[model samples]
Target: MKFFARIVAVLGGALIFFVGLGTAVFKSGLLGLVICLAAGAFVWWVFAQEREEYRGNIEALNRETGLNFKEAFGSGTTSMCIDETARKLALLEQGGAKHRLFGFEEIDDWELRWTEVSRNGSLSFQNVHFTFRTTQLEMPIFKVGVNSKLNGETWSQKLRLLMA
Candidate 1:
């Protein structure tokens, strides 16, 4: 759903951009040029804002967790990190609106999980993630958002070794 929304947004922006460009080229005078420039500036501004927000969220998460993440992955609204020195894992979701932090010892079991999506009899799998099960809770972590069974298996093995 998020991906679809993003695609739609990109298409809309492209349409506006081309329309502005076409108008300027077809002798619509300064109005077309101004529209084109404005469209470009608006797009740039939106991207810059999103980047700033993402960076701020990451910095905030680091400060709140007080852990130096050695490795991080994913983008958009979710991020996964490993604080190897601290022997902890972190999952930041919803563009850092929510997060989870847990130690290796706290994980009782873990598995790579796949979510199946079906629409109009068409089947697809996505949002592959590692499911970490603790005595107190179970949650998905490291969402890669793809059908990566091999990748998941590899990570699962690595996690098993780490937990052991």
Candidate 2:
């Protein structure tokens, strides 16, 4: 999972850091110091860039929709976000340049599908697909792929209750 990947990344960074530190203390001097500094700087830069990009995307989404999204899902322009206070969902497109806003009562139908898939004979993993159908206007059939079925189901249930 994501947590496992983070653990692995941290361990890898630590290993590199310690190796550089050891080399600086026992063998090489300037080269090892440079390695250690680069390793730490690379990690910091990677995390900082990711955080800024995510923040920018969320801010752009909010500006495009005029709704504050506590959590946004999906990627690029094809994102799904809910404004809990407004009881509304915003489907973004064209990199937030265009969007479809729908209230709970306006969503005629929706489905959350779970499927197992594998790549290059690797272990199979579950993918959750969330889809919505409405009669008010013409819209593309966008399938939002969630990380897990539980996440998809939880969102589906929340929408179900809101629409009810």
Misplaced by over 4 Å in model 2 are: 1-44, 75-77, 93-98, 117-123
Shift in Å, residue 63, candidate 1 = 2.0
Strongest candidate by TM-score: 2
Provide the global lDDT of candidate 2 against the true structure: 0.69
lDDT of 1 by residue, 58-91 (tens): 6787788787764355535666667777898777
TM-score of every candidate:
0.56, 0.57
Which residues of candidate 1, in runs, are more than 4 Å off? 1-11, 17-52, 74-76, 115-125, 137-147
Error of 1 at 143 (Å): 6.8
Per-residue error for 96 in candidate 2, Å, reads: 5.1
Pairs with backbone N, CA or C atoms under 3 Å apart (clashes), candidate 1: none
Q: Model 2, residue 138: what's the lDDT?
A: 70
lDDT of 2 by residue, 13-55 (tens): 7778888998999999887898799778766765675556556
Q: Judged by lDDT, which candidate is best?
A: 2
- lDDT: worst 10-residue window of model 2: 70-79
lDDT of each candidate versus the true structure: 0.67, 0.69
Clashes counted in candidate 1 amount to 0
